[model samples]
Structure formats: C-alpha cells, structure tokens
Target: MTSAKRVAIMVTCMVDQVMPEVGVAAVRLLRRAGYTVEFPAEQTCCGQPFFNSGFRAQAADLAKRSLDIFEPYDAVVLPGGSCAAMIRKEYPHLLERWPGGVARAEALAARTYELSEFLVHVAGWQPAPAAGAPRVTYHDSCHMNRLLGLGAESRALLSAAGCAIVEMHESDRCCGFGGVFSIRIPEVSNAMTQEKVRRADATGAEVLVSADPGCLMQMRGFAHQTGMRLAHLAVLLEELTR
Candidate 1:
C-alpha cells in the first residue's frame, strides 16, 4: 500500500446526477489501496461538455474553477475517464488559445490521473484475487487510452480479478456515448453504440468494462433499448471484497 500523499476524487456531471455509486466504488477502490482520499464538495462538471460543444470561454472558466478545486492535491483521481481525459487533454488545447490560463490548466493536468492509472501507476494498487470470476471483456475508452495513454492497465487488473479477458472485435471502437455528441448527432451516435453493443454481445462476455461513465451510460442505454445485458467494470469491481 504505497498511499498517495493526498488523492482528490472528481466525480463528473453525469455520474453526480445519474450514477453516484460509480463514484463511491472509486473511493472504495482507492481507500482499500491505502490512499488518503478527499472529495471537494465544490467539484462539478469538468467543463468537457462545454469544451466539446465548442464553447471555449465557458469551458475555460470551468477549467479554471476545476484547477482551483483540485490543484492543491498530490493527485486528482478522476473516476470518470472522460472527465480525467478532458482535464488532461482538452485543457492544454484550451490553454493554447487562452494563454492567460495555460499555466493553471497545465498545472492541473500535471497532477490529474484517471482512477486506474492512479491506482496502478501512482498508488501501486492491484485487484484482489478473483480466481473464479466470470468472463469479462474490456472496452477501452478513446479518451483514456488514446488521450491519456493508460495502456493496458485496466485489462491487467481485471485479469487479476479472476475474469477471463475476452477481447471483442474492434474493442477500441467508440461506443457513441459522446455526451452531447449523442444528442447532437443522435443517429450516428446511436448507430455506433449499437455496433459496439453488438460486438460485445458477440464475444459472449458476461460483463463489459470501461473507465468512462459517458460510454457506460450509452452502452447501458443501448442495452436497454436493444434488450442486451452486460455489467459495467465498476459494477464487477465493486462486487469484490465486500
């Protein structure tokens, strides 16, 4: 248990409103790994929605606010991979145009980390043994993998949890749950999500895991809309060592 000096939890907007349990599971995961954890009550949406929507000023303001909220910690542990990716990836670009705020946003990015990244890279935590775990497949979120470069850490952790890692076809494809992208481009988003759901189903995996809540929400919706069933990675991880 190489605990982080201080770890802050950043619960993204959708999770705050729809699925807070995912946030709780993240806290449990961190605390169990011996990280001193704190959740800033002032935290809100990571401004990604606005940023992605091309609202630069509003997104920069929200980014500034997030920097203020999280800058003091040794590491910012973002439960939602999309939010973590936004603070790290998009902020730099936002700062590129808004030079006045680059330092703060860049500093925030310097310390920010997705949950599994912090767990494995910073905190040095691993999943508890799960020798009899069910067949599980992972969906690598675009932001977490491509943007944050988390590599294969989450997949390894899931394997440690005693689950069979069934690699789905085009496992890296976007699930079309691009937050506002889904609403803005409903047909495209819906179609993409449907394809992802179909692929995951094709693997015959009992669960599909991803670090992004937006992806999870879209996948869950597609499951409900299309009558497909798959458990989230968080749901599976939370079920362990209780």
Candidate 2:
C-alpha cells in the first residue's frame, strides 16, 4: 500500500552535484518504507538562492517551473531542510503576484515534506537497530529547525535507531551555511563555523549528524581540522538500519 504513494525526490543542487550519496541514501530509506521514490529529471533549483539574493522575479520563475515538475507526484521529498522550507514556506509568498500562483504554491507546499518529516510522520518509519551503537551529536540546521519547526524528529528517529545521543553544546546554533551568506561574508561565516566545529568536537561524539546536506558540507570543511566525523542523516540512518 505504501508503494502506491509516489513521492518525487527533489535532489537539491548541492546533493545532486556534490553529495549524491545522500540522495542515494534517501532513495534507500524511502524504498525500505515501501514508497515508490521518483526523480523528476526536469527539476531544478527551488529558487532559494535567487530569493535570498533579493531577485524576486527570477526566484518566482524557478518556483513556477518547480511547481510544474513536482505537481503530479503524490508527495515531494527533499533531503535539505533549507530547500524544503523554501518550497513549503516561501513558495506561496514568492508566487503571490502570479495568476493562481498562491493557490498553486500552497497546493504544492501542502504535499511537500522534508525527508525526515515524511519518513517519521507520513510513512511511520522506524529504523532497525545497528550491531554497534555510535555516539553521535545532531546539528539542527536553521531553516529545517526554525522555519520548518523540525527539532525533535531527527533526534527521535536517531534514538529509535539505536544511536547514543551525545548532547552538543548549543546544537541549534547556526552553522553559517546560509547558502550565499557564507560566500558573501566569508570571515564572519568562517568564525561561526569554527565555533560550531568547536562545540561539535567538545561533545567528543564519534560522529556528527545533520539532515541538511549544506550543514553536512559546511561542517565537513572543518572536520579534518577538528577531528570530527560528519554524516548526513539519511546516510547515518541507512547505515544504522542496514
């Protein structure tokens, strides 16, 4: 019955281009939950970058195209919270001036869910226990946590999957991966990242997990210097469950 629900995977540009493995893990997890996962080849950016850059016209155009690509699916799932939030939270606002745009964006928003949210809430998924539990800390990505209101879902799922949760200092603080914000203000961003890496390292966690690919990449930049292992939540979950 779950397979009857066709979900389109919106592989965010970062995951598609830099971290395809996270997308692979997402597919694996969705398949294990009995859903028919799909990739809409015509899909492109959700327009967050443009929107964040104050290019409303360009962002709205991309959002409209995204609506067309994902509108036919039963649900749209993406690994990054930032992009998911862009669609679920910002799409309607961005499309407000277009004809029937509000309605279309709202409809798409209603069916879109972040992967952890979809898995935990819609699919009623629970991971099988791993043979050896790893001590881990969770990073609450800004958009995913504040915009999408998803704080405990990842922790809850990880706990159920048999990970020993280590409390990272200020786990909810921003990791400075505000898409282009990092590029715009590298000094400030690097400082914040160093602080975040310090906190993650202080936890002495065997691995640090984040649901957002952006967050994973940002933290991974300092992992070598910090001696902290980093993993996307999908990858961590897939491994634990397998």
TM-score of each: 0.93, 0.97
Worst 10 residues of 2 by lDDT: 1-10
Candidate-wise lDDT, in order: 0.80, 0.90
Residue-wise C-alpha lDDT for candidate 1, range 77-120, written one tens digit per residue: 88777888898888877867765677777778888888878877
* 113-218 per-residue lDDT for model 2 (tens digits): 9999999999998887776878899999999999999969899889989998998988999998787888999888888988998998899999999999988888
Model 1, TM vs. native? 0.93
Clashes of each: 1, 0
